[model samples]
Structures are given as structure tokens and as C-alpha cells.
Target: MNLFGKFATVGGATLLSRVFGFGREMMMASALGVGPVADAFNLAFRFPNLFRRLFAEGAFNAAFIPLFARSLESDGEGGAKRFASEIFSTLFVVLTTLTVLAMIFMPTLVRTIIAPGLAVCVDTVDTGRQAISCETRFDLTVTLSRIMFPYLACMSLMAMVSGILNAFRRFFAAAVAPTLLNIILIAVLLYAHWVGADTVTIGHLMSWGVLAAGVSQLALVVAAMRLAGFSVALGVPRWTQNLKRLLILAGPAALIGGITQINLFVGQAIASFKPGAVSILQYADRPYQLPLGMVGVAIGVVLLPELARALKAGHLREAQHTQNRSLEFALFLTLPAAVALFLIPEPIIRVIYERGAFDPTATPAVASVLGLYALGLPAFVLIKVFSPGFFAREDTKTPMRATLVSAVANTVLSFVLFQFYAEQGIALATTLAGWLNAGLLFLGLWRRGLWEIDRALVKRGALVLLASLAMGALLLVELHLLSDWLVPAAGLHRQLAALAFLVASAMAVYFACTVLFGAVDRSMLMKLAKGRRGRAKAAE
Candidate 1:
């Protein structure tokens, strides 16, 4: 598919999933609010999510894509299926074992890794600007974490299956798999509320819902992969060149490329002590994930195959060009998003999540973290897009080394920043780490002279950045003008209108200014705007 069509196909599916997720969060905020119960739910879910990214999206994709593409290229459909079957079978056993271990060690694990959740139990709970006993916070976290812990097993399996499906060129079911998760969560929340489930029991109900979402997501993706003519079996393991290759690549990929997520886990740990910190991070993560999911994941998935093919054919120039173009697209798209989030995240969060359990105080706090996250949005996307450059060339060590640097930087920054800014500081630290990672990657590639942005790309990038800044300024003006109409100081109606105005004005201003200044290439913009579609950056 052309870049635009592929983005639309993948991004559209992602957008649907994110919107459903937003709905789920909305329901959650209404029911849970920003309290200990909410923290428990967030804490419980993140463990599974952390592992899910490790095994499914970030780490799994890093290893799976190159191997899948290679299998398909050299061995045809039959070869690819056999390879997938072998890996799938082994993965099942591994994940099953891992799940049991996690459950058995859940408490100890939480204490060690997510210790803040445990510590919160010893501290006071912030119950709407008031303090409650530490036992309440700790007990809530412990119970909820236990209930939702099984989701790790379910989602890990789901991610493995999704990788297989993507290899089979079946993107839709896997792409939409997350929608089921969000949908299930939404339904559970709505039902629980409608039936007037006791407030005390809502945390327990939500934990079960988290588990349900995991099972549904895993089962759906596995079924789709099976229907796509691939199956996994837990057969006796044997050494294979492909398996060995995957392991060799995967180890470093996970170590290096997956550092960002590791830092997130770190952030989670650090944020645990602060009241409502975990929930605030989760709320902010929603919008931050939108662009990351759409562009970053899509590019990582698509470009690796393309680059692997080119590299396998000894087409270095083609691979290099692809990297450059994808980087440009990522930078072009994400820069503006960063600016927008930094400037007007309050209205965005207010419109999307400021009802039910999510209150006004929660809005700006969440928005503040979102802004912090936005600072690294472009880098986050770029890392995913550019990573295959190293991976496709069978060089994972450099990225791995860079990742180690970033992980340390992230950890150090978290400790230092948390002392000052609390929850948002942890987020900002993560953003700083990401920018460092991206800078290092680009510098590495440049040192090897593998990535080059010619004068055209440089000029184009400048135009995009300049125009984006113009758009940002326009938003600053319109936001103040539309403040009363957007959220005002009170009432739902005014808040709703104010939000609509903020969105419309921002869109009008950004598009108008960028289009006028020729930020996006005019010809390309028209083609893309008209839905003709073209290659856009993978990471953004």
C-alpha cells in the first residue's frame, strides 16, 4: 500500500482502538475517580501492559518482523508457517511458565519492582485533598494488583499471536484486537455503574474486567492468526538457524530498543508513592500513545520488512533513503503534536476524560504530564522508525548500548526530577531520556554515514518546524479567546463548547498556517489531503 493508505488503514484502526480506550477511561474516571482504587487499577494493569510491550509490541515486533519477512522471502508461505509454528509453540510454553511465576511471586514482585504501591499502603491516601490511612492505599493496591495480574499471561500470548498474524499479512484483526480490550472495559464499567455496584466493590469488578480484556484480546488475535493459515504448537524444541538468529537479535533489541518502556516501569515505581500519581500517568499516557501507536508502530512494522528486503538484496541506498524519508515524516508530523500538547492539553484532556471519576483537578495534572510526554513524542516515534535501520543490518549492539545509556539517564533523571516536580517530573525525565536516545541513534547513523537528509529534506524540515511554530502561536491566541467557550471556569455546557472551539480553532490555525507557508509540500499535501495517500513516517 502507499504510505498514506497504509497509515490510514493501520492508523484508522488504531484511532478506533484509542477512541474506544478513551471511552473506557472515561467510564473508569467516572466510576473510580482519581483515588486509591484508581491507583490500584492503574498499577495492576501496567504490569501486564509492561510485559505486553516487551513480548508483544516492542520486543516481539523487533525480532518477529525481520524473521517473518526473511522466512517469507526465502522459504515462501510454507517456510514462514513452519518457522512461526516452531516459535509460537515455544513462546506458549515460555509465557505459560512466566505467567505462573508472576502470579506466584505477585506480592514479592510488586514489593520489589512496584514497591511504591506497597509503600503507599504505609503512607496516607490523598482522598480528594485529604489524607487517609496508609493501610487503605496498600490494601487496595495489593488486592487490585492480584486480581489483574493474570492479564500479563493473557496479553503476552495475545502479543505473540498478533506478531504471527502480522507476518501472515493479516493486520486488521490484530490491529483491532486492542479495541476488544477497551470495549470490554467500557462495557464492564457501564454495566457495573448501571446496576449500582457498590463503590467499595468497583475496584474488584474492574480488576476482573482487566483480566477479561486480556483473554479476549489474546483469543481474538490467536483465532485470527489461525484463520490466516498459521498455527502454533508447543512441540519439543530444537535448534534452528532462524530461531538462533531471532534470539540473537531479540536479546539486544529488548535491551536497547525497549529501554523506553523499561523507563516507564521505572516511572510507575517512582510515581507510586505520590497520591493519584499512577492514575495521572495513565490518563496522560492515553493521548501520548495515540500518535505513538499510529505512526511509530505502523512504521516499525512496515519499514523493517521493506528495509530487510532491501538490505538482503544488498540495496544499501534504498534502505538509507527509506530511513531518511521515514525520519522526515516522523519529525514533520510529531513536532506539531508536541507543540499542541504542550500548549493546550488541558482542553483535550477535559473534553475526553473530565467526567465521572475524573475531576477538574485531575484534568490539568494529567494534562501537565501529557505535555511532558509530548516533549519526547517525536523522539519516541523516531526511535521506532529508525531502529530497523540497525536491526535490518543485523547490528543490534549499538542500539542496545544507546539504550543502556538512555535507561540509566531515565532512571537518574526520574530520581532527581521526582524530588522536585513529583509525578510530572518523572514523565519529563522519561521525555528527556527519549530525546537522548533519538539523538544518539541519529548520531550513530550519521557517524556510519548511513543516514543522510539532503538539502531538500533539510529545507522541508525547516519549513515544517517553522510552520508548526506559527501554528503553535496561533493556538496560544485562540486558546485564550476560546477559553470561556471551551471549559470556562465552571459547568459542563461551557466546558463542552470551549473544548470544541479549542479543537476547531487549533485545526484551522495549524492547517491554514502550514498550508500557507508550504510547510507540507503543497503537491504532497493536496494528494494526502484528498486521501490519495503516500508514504508518511512510520514512527509518528
Candidate 2:
């Protein structure tokens, strides 16, 4: 398949997963609302997920895929498998050790890092109605963190397996494995709601569900690995020269790769000072993540391997083409989505998460946060597009420096902003930090002669922006037209229909505008379609 074909393979699966994720979050909002248990659960889940991203999916994959591709090219399948097994054993040991330590120190992690505000909230006299004691929230977070910490081990191993699959160009299983997490959690939430479980019970069950999903996801990719005629043996961990080199690359990549997570962590920490702020941010996050996951994550996954192979073969022109196309693809999809999110956050949030325990009063606050996050959506995807340019060349330190600068800016801004604007301020800080990071990454590549904006990309980029603005204008008009159906007082079905119509209209308008304005190359799209038809004929 071609690059766009590969992107579709991964992005389509991610779209499925994100759709399921929306279901999961909607259920959580109904069952748990923005209560103390919901807050605790969100924090506990993020704790393990933070580590998973930092150590496994983010840093490990950034450093691993290029080297793994190199192994496959230079060392043959046997040598590549051996290399994978060695790396797998080492990853298994390291993550296991980290999980144990994290579980043991759960309270400290919660008190100091995860949600220190819980401790402080316990001492503050509630001048308002108290749904649950702050003490309970603190203890619940610690308990849930310990219960789910083992998920880190499972997912980290899964990441290594996924890297192996991506290197081999078998993208589907690795891409689809994440859906299990959402599917499992959705099932758990359904059960919890059906049984009429309390918030605390639901939180505990969800934690266990997370652990189960991790195992299921790992099993899936491992099975895929075997089916692909590849296997990694589990043996004693060995410290080889490759391991040392991996550490050197991953050490910096960890921070650089996890910059987005780190920024979220900072926001979570600061948002913790206010009740329900974490869950609010998380709710706002889900809508924007759909586009980011579909476009940014998919492109990043496919682009890195494609770029690495191109550069490895000394095909500099091919590498440049891959980078430019990836950037064009990212902006084309992301800009319009960002526009929609920014323009209609309230309606989106209301439709997705406004029933049951979720108070209608919180809708505006969540919408505001969502809008600020939307402004940074394109920046977030741009980071994904550009970072692979460096990673494919095995340079992690440059992005790491940019990430550190962004991280510091986010931390300082979040701290100052949270004091003033609360959750929205934190959201704003993250957005600014993302743009800063994306700008620096882009500049680094351009200055180092690693990447340049070709004329096609520049032309398409301008058109994409123009089309996005046109879509935004139409969306605002749609919102006005559908105001009656989108209101909080409207029935769920009406709201759903209205939001669906809005989305359909927005997509239609954006596509029409892009095509009319020549933002996309019709000939390239035709080539992709022809390739698909040829593949189908071959299969027949």
C-alpha cells in the first residue's frame, strides 16, 4: 500500500477506537458525573497512563522504530527478531520494576504528584455543600492508583510489540489494539450503570477494567506478531550495546515524546485545586482527541517508519516528500476540526456529556476549556507531523530541548493562569505551550536543513486555512439555526440529530471548499483510488 493507504488503515482503526471512547466517556459522565469519585478515578487512571505514555508508547517507540527498521534492513529477519526479543526482555524487566515501585509508593505519588490538592482539600472547611469528604477522595485515588499501576507493565510490553509490527508494515493489529481499552471500559461502565453501582464502586470497577484492557491489548498484538511470522522470545534481560544506545536516545526522547502528556499532567495538577476541574478538562479533551488521534497519531505512526526507511535508503527526496505530505495531511484534517470545536464546543459537550450526574451548570465552563484546547488542536497535530522528521533521523535531543522549553512555559503559565481563570486558564496555558513547541520543532528542522516547506505544501497549507475559516463561518450559522435543538432543555435525540447534522454539514462544506479551491490534488487522490482498485483486482 501507499502512504495515504497506510494512514487510512491506522486512522480508520483509531476513529473506531475514538468513537468507542466517546461512548465510554458519555457513560462515565452519566454514572459518575463530576463527583469526588469521578475526580479520583480520572486522576488514578491518568497516573498509570502518564507513565505508559512517557516510558512506553512515546519514548520507547520514538527510539525503537528507527533502530528496529535498521535491524530489519541490515541484520535480516533472524537478527531483527533477536534484537526485538532482547529489547522486549529488557522492557519487561524495567516496566515491571517501575510498576512495583510506583505501587509501593502510591500514597506519595498521589500526595505529591498525582493530586496533591486532595490533601489540601481535606483541611479546608467546605463553605458549600460537600458531596464526599476530601479525605475519601485522597484515599480513593491512592487505592485506585495501586490497583491500576500494573497496567503500566502490560501496555509498555504492548508498545514494544507494536513497534515491531509497525516496522514490518503490519499496521492494523497494533493500531486496533487500543480499541480494546475503550471497549472493555465501555462494557464495565455499562455493567456498572445496569447494576446501579455507586460512584466509588464504578471507579474501582473501571480501574480493574483498565488493567484487563491492558492485558487484552497486549495479547492482541502478540497474536498479530505470531500471525505475521514473527516472534520474540521471553528470556533473561541482557544489557547489550544496543540497550545502551536505546537508553541514550530514549532518555531524551522520553521527555520530548511525552511533552503532550507532561503538559496535560501539569494542567491536571493545577486543575486539582478546584473540585471537578480534572474531570471537566478530561471531558473537554475527548472531542478534540478524536481528531488528534485520527489525524495526528495516525500520521505520526506511519510517517516515522516511512521517513526512516526513505532516509535509510539514502532517498533524501523521498524523505522530504513523506514529511511534506504528512504535514499537508495533518493540517488539512486538523484545521477544520479545530474550527468546529472552537465554534460549537457547548453543543458538542452538551450532546456528549450533559445527562445524569453531569450538571447542566458546568456546561459553559467545559465548553470554554474545550474552545481553548481547540485553538491548540492544529499545533498539537503539527508537533506530531514535525517530530517524526527528527526521530526518523535518530535525533531525539533537539526535540527534547524544545519540549523542555515548552514544558517549563506550560508549568509556569498553568500555575499563574489557574490562580486567575481556574480550568480555562490552565487550558489556555497548554495551548500556548503547544504552539511554542510546534514552532520550535518546525524552525529546528528548517534551520538544520532537515526539512523545508515545498511549494505544494505552502499552497495547500494556505488553502486548508482558508477552507477551515469558511467551514467555521458556516458552522456558526448552523449553530444559530439549530439553537433550539441544541439547547440543554432539548431532548437527547434532538440534540444528537442536530449535532450530527452540524457535523455532516461542516464536513461537506469543508470538502467542497477544499476541492473547489484546489487545496487537495485531485490527481493524487485518483492515484490512491486506482491503487486500491488494483489491490482489489490482485486479491481477486
Candidate 3:
């Protein structure tokens, strides 16, 4: 299928997952809120999620998909399957060993790296009216981390299978796996609520749910791989030449992932010192992630495979065109989202999370963080777009070096900022670091002559920015006019109505401005749709 079609398939599935993820977060906010249990759970969950991103989503795919795609292109089905089996066996062994080791040392991991602040006793004032003790939170985080670490192993293997499927141009199943995770977590939340479980108990159940979700997600992609006419079976580990090359690429990719995740770990560790700070940051982060996951990740997933295939077949022009259009498409969606998040964060956070245990007083802090995060949204999406230019060419070292700079910036800034601005300062540091990372990646791609921006793309990007600014202006006006209607005192129905109107109005203004400015046209969209169908037919 065409790039746009593949993106739609992946983005649509991701959108569904993000929607359900919102529901899951809403339930979590109600059930746990910004309490000690919530803080502990977020920290615990971060352990496995950190590795999952490092191994499964980030490094493994960066190393695996391109090679897997090239194998299919040159060596055909048998060669591709053999390569996949070797990688799968090696990945399974490595991840399993890592998970076991991590689980065994969960307490040391938590104490040393994850959330050392949990060790100290805090005064009641520091506890912020939450009765759960710091020591209790510390113990619970260790236990929950142990419970969830196995998920990393499951998901890493699952990611390899996903890479195989993506190589085969099968995006649906892998795209939908995350939705299953949200679904399972939501179910566990509901069941816990029904059972009248305590917050700590609910947290424990949720961690277990993560492991279960991993298994379910792995089973799903495995089934998808089989259905796509590839059988990837478990075998003893082997150190073949292909495996050596994969390891060579994967080492830097993994380091890059590690560096990037360290930024998050630093932010969270700093946030953990204050009660409810981690949960507050998490709540603020979820809304912006909707667009990021839907657009950025979808573009990254589809773009990498597409670029790999093009470059493999010696189609440099095709690769460059794909990169440009992907960037344009990403900016077209991401700019408006950044504007909305920056301008109306309070209303968005209040509407989604203010109910239940999420305190009204916490709204301002969460909203501020959300707005700061929005400032970096475009940078985040651009990273997704541009990094593929290097990864597809097996140039992982450049991004790793760039990530190291950003990581150091993030780590130093996070500490420096937290001393003054607290959680919001850490959020700001993350935003600035993201922009730095994107800039470095872009410069590297341009220097290597891999990325070229045409006049049309620049004009469209300028128009998108202008349209987004216009939308932001409209949103400020709407929020001012309906300010009272967005508050908790306005009741849920009124708040929902005002939010809906604001979103609809913003979308209308942005789209209208885009058309007027000649950024995008109906004919272009129709042609894209037609091209998608033609490509799909050709694939069949």
C-alpha cells in the first residue's frame, strides 16, 4: 500500500488504542488519583515500560525491521524466515535473561535508580493529605516492578514478530496490540473497583494486568505472523553473521533508546521527591501523547519500512519523497494539537481528569506541565519523521551521539530545574531537550545528504504553522467566552459540551485556514486516496 494508506491503517489503530488508553487513564485517575499508590504504580510501571521502549519498540525495531525487509527483498521467503528465527531466538534468550536478572534485583533497581525518594520518611505536610507512608510506597514499587518486569521479555519478543509482520507490509495486527493492553488494563481496573479493592491492591492487580497484556499482545502478533505466511518458531540461540550485524546495529540503537529513556527516568526520579508529583506529570502527559502516538509513532513505523524497502531497491528519490510527505503529514496534524494543548490545557485536563480523586487544586500544575509539553510536541513528531532517514541506512551511531547530548542536557536540566520550578521545571527541561534532539537529528540527516526539504514542503509547513496559530487564537477567544462553562462548578455536561464545541471550532478554523492558504486541497486528498487503493490492488 501507499505511505498514506499504511499510515492511516496504523494511525487509525493507534487512535483507537489512544482512546482506550484515555479511558484507562481516566479510570486510574478516579481509582488512584495523585496519591502515594498512584505515584508508586507510575514508578513501578515505568520500570518495565522503560525497557520495553528501549528493547521492544525503539532499539529492536530499528535494528530488526530494515534488515528483515532487506532480507525479504534479496533472499526471498526462506531466507527471511531463517533470519527472523535466528533474531527471535537470540532476542528471546537475551530478554528473558535480562528480565530475570532485573526481577531478582528489583529492590536495588528501585532504590538506586527508579525512585530513591521513596526511602525517606516525609512529614504529613509533605504527604499532602494522602495517608499512605513513603516506606509503604517504596516497598510496593519494588514488588510491582518485579511483577511487571516479565512483560519486558514478552514484549521484546513480540516486537521481533511485529518487525517480521511490518516487513511483510502487515501493519494492522501489530498496530492493534496496544489497544489490547489498554483493554486488559481497563478490565482489571473495573474488576478491582467492583471488588472494592484498596488502592495498593488495585495497583498490584494493574501490574499483573500488564504482564497478562504482554502475553496477549505477543500471541496476537504471532498469530498475525502466521497468517501472513511466515512461521517464526522458538529455537536455541545462534550467533550467525546476520545476528552479528543485527547486534552491531542494535547495540547503538539500544544505547540511543537507553539515553532517551534516561531523560524520562531523570524527570520521574526528580518528580518522585514530592508527593503526587509523578502522578501529576503522568496525567498531564497522557493527553499530548494521543496525537504523538497516533501521528508520530504511526509515521515512524510505516516510514522506516517504506524507506528501507525503497533504499534497498536503490530508489533514493522514492525514499526522499516518502520522508518529505511523512514530515508534512505529521506536521499537518501535530501543529494543531500542540496549539490546542498549549492554549487550553486547563479545560482539557479538567474535563478528562478532574473528576473523582483528581483534586481541583492540582489542575493548574498539571495544566502548566501539559502546556510546556505542548511546546515540544512538534519537535517530538519531527524526531519520529527524521530518525528513519538514518535508521533505514543502518546509521544508528549518529542518532546515538545526538541522543547522548540530549540525554545529558535533560539530566542536568532536570536536576537544576527541579530545585526551582519543581515538576513543571522538569517538564520544561524535557521539552527543551526534545527540541535539541530533533535539531541534532535533522542536522545529521542533512549533513549526510539524506534529508532534503523542497519549496512545496516548506510552504505547506509555513501554512500549517499559520493555520495552527489561527486556531490557537480562536481557542483563546472561545475559552474566554466560555470560561465559566469549562469549570468543575459548571457540571460535567456543561464542561463536556464546552470542550466539544471548542475542539470542533478549532478543527474547523484550522482546516478552513489550510484550504484558504492552499496548504492542502481536496484534489490532493482524492488523489492520495486513489493512489492508496491502486497500491493496495498492486500488492494483492
TM-score of every candidate relative to the true structure: 0.92, 0.96, 0.95
Measured over all alpha carbons after superposition, the RMSD of each candidate to the real structure, in angstroms, is 3.9, 2.0, 2.7
Where does model 1 exceed 4 Å of error?
Answer: 124-133, 487-490, 525-540
Judge candidate 1 at residue 421 and give its lDDT.
Answer: 97
Which model, 1 or 3, shows the larger TM-score? Answer: 3
lDDT minimum window of 10 residues, candidate 2: 122-131
For candidate 3, the per-residue lDDT at 233 reads 64
Greater-TM-score candidate between 1 and 2? 2
**Displacement of the residue 193 alpha carbon in candidate 2, Å:** 1.7
Candidate 1 deviation (Cα RMSD): 3.9
Q: Residue-wise lDDT of candidate 1 within 132-153, one digit each (tens)?
A: 5767666666677777877777
The lowest-lDDT stretch of 10 consecutive residues in candidate 1 is 531-540
The lDDT values for all models are 0.77, 0.87, 0.85
**lDDT assessment of candidate 1:** 0.77
lDDT for each residue of candidate 3 in 1-540, tens digit (9 for 90 to 100): 667878899999899999999999999998887888888889988877777666655467888887887788789988888898888888788878888888888889888888977766474323333466666778888999899888888878887888788777788898888898899999999999899888778899999999899899999999888888789767999889999999889877776644445666789987888888899888887898899888977887888878887898899998888898998998899999998999999989888988777778888999999999999889888888877888889989899899889988998999899999999998899899999999999999998789889887899999999999999999988988998999889999999999999999999999999989988746877898788798899999
Give the per-residue lDDT digits (tens) of candidate 2, residues 384-440: 888888888889889989999999999999999998999999999999999999999
lDDT of 2 at 249: 86
User: Which residue pairs collide in model 3, if any?
Assistant: none
